[model samples]
Target: MTKNKIEKIFKILSKQISNPKTELTYKNPYTFLVSVVLSAQATDKSVNASTVKLFKIIKRPEEMIKLGETKLKKYIKTIGLYNSKAKNIINLSKILFEKHNGKIPSDFNLLTSLPGVGNKTASVYQNEILNIPRVAVDTHVFRVSNRIGLVKTKNPDETQIKLESIIPKKWLKSAHHLLILHGRYTCKSQKPLCGDCVVYKHCSYIKSEQNKKNISSQ
Candidate 1:
């Protein structure tokens, strides 16, 4: 995307949500990390439904270790991949206590090295907790960026790199939230509300015209 388009797009998004935050609810960094891990392929509402009770009992790594994998699974069973997620969360919490002195590591490599933590999850942890300027591209950011001509990439990692390079430093922190909210509310995968989209003029997706036609027909 051009510099002007990027700026304009971000400006519109920022105005819509002055302070955008992750929908996943957590009280601290450890809980936040756990929440993001559970959020993979799961809705925030589902994760929150489980974590609201999960966090109350185990807010810290030591607490999570006390909970154990078998028991943790009971709480997160509603989320997809809960069996493995529970195992990873339990093991990762143990590592946090043993290796990191019961603290969530701020370093990306260290964070990613933990069980169940990948690039996307690590970026989210660092960006939200440590105030880093990394773009953690989820499905929302990936689809919206492509549709809006921000990046012509095949995957989230490449799209994240492209966005970080092109997105102005001023908007870097909020880019993830902006793109995500836009996708969730406006530029959805099916039946994107193009007429209501703030960046409709900047979108490059040919399907948007068809969407407008479909809407008008209705």
Candidate 2:
């Protein structure tokens, strides 16, 4: 896409989503990191539901480690892969407490070194906490960016690189949340609500579907 079109697409999305931010709830950086880890392959709603009580008592890495993986699993049992998530959370907490002095590291490499914190999680933590401009590619971001012709990549890592390079720097900070919210509400995986989509005019998926319909009806 042309630079002007990309700029326009973000502008429209910004207008549509007045306050684009993570839906996950947490009290501090430590809690936010844990929430992000637990959110892998899970909904924000589910993470929030689980973290409501969990975060109330566990605000630091030490607290999380003390909570133990067994108790952590009880809190997040409803979420998928809670077994592994709980283990990772406890393990990461131990690393943070023992190695990082119980503080979440600002360095991307150090953050990713923690268990359960991958590229997307590290990017998200840095972006939200450290005020870094990073476009973290989750499922929603990957799907929406590809569907709207933002980037034609097969994986999240490639999509992130392409989007960060192509998108205007001014919009990079909010792009992650904007695309996620848009995909969650309008441009869904199944039965997308094209009529309600603010950027439908710029969506390649919509245009492609229209062309297919026209061809079939001809």
Candidate 3:
């Protein structure tokens, strides 16, 4: 897509949901990192519900290690992959304490090296916390970007690369949230709300549907 079109798409999305931010409730970077780890293949609502009580008591890495993996799993049992995620969280917390002095590292490589902190998680932490312009392509981003003709990629990594290359730097910071919200609410996987979508005009999915309708009518 062209620079102007990309800007228009994001501007409209931003207007719809002003000050778009992560739905995961957390007190600090430590909690945010844990939430992202728990959010793998899980919903933000689920993560928030799980973290609500947990965050009140144990909001730091050292505290998490003290909580132990078993207790951590019990706290996040509602989320998917609770057992493995709990282990990763505990292991990562130990690393945070031993290496970074319980602070979340700003470096992407260092962040990814942590257990459960994949590319998507690292990008999310960087974007929200560090204000880095990294497009974290989750399922929503993958579907929405392709549907909107923003990128014609196969996987999340490809989508991320294409998005970072094409999307204007000005919109990069907010693009992750904008695209994610648009996909989650408007451009859904099963039945998209095309009529209600603000960027329907620019959506290739809508255009394709129109073409099909025209062909059928003809």
Segments in model 3 whose C-alpha atoms lie over 4 Å from true places: 216-218
Ten-residue stretch with the least lDDT total in model 3? 72-81
- TM-score of each candidate structure, all chains considered together: 0.94, 0.98, 0.97
Tell me how many clashing residue pairs each candidate has. 0, 0, 0
Q: How well is each residue in 26-145 modelled by candidate 2, as lDDT tens digits?
A: 898888998999999999999999999988888998887888989889999999999999999999989988998899889899988889999999999988888899999999999999
Write down the RMSD of all candidates, one decimal each. 3.0, 0.8, 1.1
For each candidate in the order shown, give its overall lDDT on alpha carbons: 0.90, 0.93, 0.92
- Candidate 1 C-alpha error for residue 121, in Å: 0.3
Cα lDDT for residue 213, candidate 1: 89
Clashing pairs in 3: none
Q: lDDT tens digits, residues 48-163, model 1?
A: 99999888888899999998888999999999999999999999999999999999988889999999999999998988899998899999999999988888999999988999
- Model 3: what TM-score? 0.97
On TM-score, the leading prediction is 2
